[model samples]
Target: MSIRHGLLALLERGPRYGYQLRTEFESRTGSTWPLNVGQVYTTVARLERDGLVVPAGEDEAGHALYAITEDGRDELRRWFTTPVDRASPPRDELAIKLAMAVGTPDVDVRAVIQAQRAHTIQAMQDYTRLKAQALEAAAARPGVFDPDDVAWQLVLDQMIFQAEAEARWLDHCETRLVRLAPQAVADRREGADNPPSDGDGTAEQADGAPQRSPARVGGLRGALRRPRR
Candidate 1:
């Protein structure tokens, strides 16, 4: 999230002070990306220095006001038009942890995946519950649509989707680990010798199979490529 761009976008509406910008930004974004008042002031100052915004004047309460300039409008246009740079993806802590878990001595990679799956599932449940409550609250007051409720719901939906994707990715990681295990090769050989009657030969692994060190998949680079469901 670019705080500078966000602040600039808020200023594009009209002249707004620091507090007003912070409040409006939170209201529009459902507080998903919170901005400190000091941070807002600092960003505004930088905007002024860069000639993106000009001091409109103080409000009635003596709060310093700012208004976006032509340059700021151009910048905001570029921000909206240009696609986000995915060539250099942001670092995700979970991805980093999972990448380290593979091939690391004494680390149970399956256990790590399971732990993350559980946590992600719990977060998804929480978001679902919140969405239900938000809908119920909105339905109680008919005819009047509150934009804040809608904004919050949108934020919740994004979180829910992310949690679901995380869970799926974790499951994929476990499957990949199992497939790359040494015993998996031996199991395939055994199946070749004594094929299952079903003919699919996709039976589960037998007990007491020898487990080998988990293999790393190109470090953290390949982690972003989610497996198809």
Candidate 2:
């Protein structure tokens, strides 16, 4: 989620001070995307710099109120209509760490993955417990319970679904690692990093360096699975 676009969209509705915008945003998104006062002020400064928003007024402390410009409106629309790309949705530090683990020597990638899996499973259990509490509280309140709060419940449900899927993926990765362990052991007896020159394989390269074609997941599903010369 682009914080700038979210702020811009909020301003498009009308001029708002930093605190009001932050409170309104949390309420509207059901507390999913919590914004700090500093982050909100920083985003406003960026919008002002970009000329996408201008000062409306100020608080008693002289903090500027922000109002959206035509450019801001255009950007807000673009953000809403254009879906976030899964390939590069956002920069996730955890994902980066996992990718780097793939190339690191003396690191047991399986242990790393398993440790993460265990943590995620614990998180999923916590989420489930919280969801149950919410439901129980709602049931007790009955009439006072605003059904709109179900939005948070839905978010919790999606979190659980993703956690389950991740657990399954971990199982898949572990099985693959176990199956390849014997081959890996043999490779270690030789020079582990060296290629098997006599095998049914050759590295494809662009320019003079080995490169991967855009064949996702081994690229063997739709195309013929053959070694490059």
Best by lDDT: 1
TM-score list, all predictions: 0.75, 0.70
> Candidate 1 residues 7-35, lDDT tens each?
89888879999999999889877787988
Instruction: Tell me the tens digit of each residue's lDDT in model 2 across 51-142.
Output: 99999988787866889999989888888898775543456565677678767888888898899899889989988997898788778887
- C-alpha lDDT values of all predictions: 0.85, 0.78
Task: Estimate candidate 2's RMSD in Å.
Answer: 5.8
- In model 1, where is the ten-residue run with the lowest total lDDT? 208-217
Stretches of candidate 1 exceeding 4 Å from the true structure: 141-145, 183-229
